[model samples]
Structure formats: C-alpha cells, structure tokens
Target: MQQLQILSGSWEQFAQDAKLIREQVFIQEQQIAAEDEWDSEDAVSLHFIAYDQGQAIATARLLENNSIGRVAVLKEYRGQGVGRVLMQSIIQLAQQQGRSFVKLSSQVHALPFYASLGFIAEGEEYLDCGIPHMDMRLCF
Candidate 1:
C-alpha cells in the first residue's frame, strides 16, 4: 500500500486532491443535497486532504469556531485509518488556533465511528440528504 500524504489549505487555495475528494464523496456518490453541501462559510474555512500517491483518499474541512464538516474517505479507503488521521489533523489544527471545541453533524451510520474518536452525540437524529444524522461535539 502506498503511504498517504496530508496537506492543509485555505478554501480559497485548496489542492487538486481536496477538490477531487469533495466531488466524489459529496457530490457524485452521496448526493448530499447541493444546498447542504455548500455555504458561504467555506470562504473562511480550512480544508485538508489525504493523498495516496497523489490520489485523494480522504478530506475534511474545519471552519473558524471549530465546526467540522464534509469529512469523507473514498469508499475503497474507508476503515483504513485514513479518516482517523484526517480528523486528528483537523482537531490539532483547531487546538493550535486556540479553539477549545469542535463540532460536526455525522450521518447515523457513522455515529459509532465518530463516537470512538471522542465526538459525543448531542441531539436527536434528523434527516439529511435522505439519511439520518445527529449533531455531535468534542471539547477540549
């Protein structure tokens, strides 16, 4: 297996890998409702991407105030620790910026995954993109 490389970028200047993962995971496969997938907030957020031999394998975005979203790993790469590494990186970035909390809305199927990483479910499940989701948070 090829080693994965991670890069951090501002939304205004994300790399090809970042764009690729977003297109595949959010747009094509998940059909995340275009309206919910994008917002004016991206203009000031930080984006990260994991690349294996130059191919995008994972991605996530962390906005100011530590709100995390759009976290995804290609289906073929899911469960390989790629998502963990990406989340850890984003969490670290949040801390380095003096942020004390990070929050995310995770799909119901992925609740256990985030829970294992210390994100606690804080609200009732609701429909998102035709799938159930819940608000979650992790505070330092």
Candidate 2:
C-alpha cells in the first residue's frame, strides 16, 4: 500500500527525495532552467509525498491558488499508479479548499497524462524552460 503523507513527519525525506526527483526529471532529464524550477511561490505551497516500501517514490505541490505543479514519480516507479496517487491528492486538496479549478502547465508530451486526470487543455501551447508545454485546467 502507498502512504499519502503531508510534508511533516519526513521533512528531510521530503526535501531530499523531492529535490532528487525534480532534479532528475525537471533539471536533468527535461533540462528545465535551474532558476525556473525554484520559484518564490514555494514558500506557501503545500507538498505531498508518497511512500512505497518505506521509500519516497512520488511527490507533487499545490500552490495557494490550487495550482498543481512539479509533480514527479521516481523513474523506476513510473506507470505504477504513483503519479495517480499524487494527482489524486492534488484533486482532493482542490475540492477541500472549495477551489473551482486546478491549473497546471503540462509538458506537451504529458498532455494526455494530465487529460486522463480530467485536466483539459486551455489556450495554445507555449514553451517553458525550453520545453513545449500547454496550460491545463481541471474544474472542481
């Protein structure tokens, strides 16, 4: 079973694993600019980390406006429902906050992935961190 825990009990684990995952996927794999990945908005963001077999395998962040971003699951754990757990948590948080919509910038290739989670594309595609992306919103 996967454990959905807030960024509390495992602060170090969260920071390390999240940094590692983001560093790999966003920074290295995707080549997102270093400064682009670290934003001032992180100060008030709510972060969720999922653990499987006692390891932090997935994570995502919820900004104050209910925007979901920086979602990632470890390479070895991809396609195993880890991203599903991360998105599931984000959706629940949006509902709890009485937020009407959840917005996210999805890499062009991952558009269908977000679509599967009920996020519809909005406007034309754009580029961020040198990668093609599109804005997606999910209404609650």
Candidate 3:
C-alpha cells in the first residue's frame, strides 16, 4: 500500500485534481452523464482529495448541510484503503466542526462500505442519475 496524503479545502483549492478523479470514476467508469456529474454545489462544498505519491486517487465533498457527496476512488486505488482513509478524514472534520450528524445519498451497492463507517441507512432506495441509492447518516 502506498502512503496517501489527504487534503481538504474549498473546491477552488483542488478542483483540477478532484475533477480528474471524479471524471474517471463517475463519468468514464460509471457512465454517468457529464451534466449529472458536475454541479454548482461543488463551488460551495468543502472538497477532500487523497493523493498517493502525488497523484489524486480519491475524492469526496461535504456540503453546507453536513451532507457528504461526490465520493469517487480511482479504479486502481479502490481496494487499497484509500477510500476508507479519505472518508475518515471527512468524518473527523465533521466531528471537529460540532456537526450533529453527517448524511449522504449512498449508492446501494456501496451501502456496506458506508455502514462499516457507522452510517445507517434510512428510507427506501431511490434512483439518482439512474443508479439506485439510499439515504444514510452518521450521528455525532
């Protein structure tokens, strides 16, 4: 496993690196449309990116409402714990900010991954961008 350096800041601080990973994972790999992949929320959210040996390997963002979204891990780095580490960083930041809870619309297939991180699924699964997803949250 390679050492991963996680950084968090506004979208402008890491838009290039973040977009690269998202495009590869969500657009190119998952076949999500370009319009559905990019959103104005990116400009207002706090973005997180994981760099392995200087290459962006994973990315996620936390919105003002304490909701997390846009999580993507490069195919080559998916099973290497890069996503776990990236999420831990975001969870820790939310705790530091005194947030009551952090929520997300998680892809149905990835439910187990988020559950392992203490997120609980709520409500029925729904389609978002043609993919099944469930609402999940982790209370502080």
Q: For this target, which candidate reaches the highest TM-score against the unseen true structure? A: 3
Candidate 1 shows a clash count of 0
lDDT for each residue of candidate 1 in 24-87, tens digit (9 for 90 to 100): 8888898876677778877787888888898878888888767898898998998788998889
* CA error at residue 5 for candidate 1, angstroms: 1.6
* Ranking, lDDT, top scorer first: 3, 1, 2
Give one digit per residue, the lDDT tens place, for model 3 in 10-117: 988999999999899999998999999998999999999999888888999999999999999989877888889999999999999999999999999999999999
The parts of candidate 2 lying over 4 Å away from their true place are 1-13
What would the per-residue lDDT of candidate 2 be over residues 1-140, giving only the tens digit for each residue?
Answer: 45545342233336677777788877887778888898776566777777786677777888878688888887888887778867877798779878999999998988998999999999998878778989999997
Which pairs of residues collide in model 2? none
State residue 31's C-alpha deviation in candidate 1, in Å: 2.2
| TM-score of decoy 2 | 0.87
- What's the lDDT for all of these models? 0.85, 0.78, 0.94
Model 2 root mean square deviation, Cα atoms:
2.5
* Ten contiguous residues with the weakest lDDT in model 3: 74-83
What C-alpha RMSD separates each model from the true structure? Answer: 1.6, 2.5, 0.7
Better of 1 and 2 by TM-score: 1
TM-score per prediction, in order, is 0.90, 0.87, 0.98
Candidate achieving higher lDDT, 2 or 3? 3
What is residue 139's positional error in candidate 3, in angstroms?
0.2
lDDT of 3: 0.94
Segments in model 3 whose C-alpha atoms lie over 4 Å from true places: none
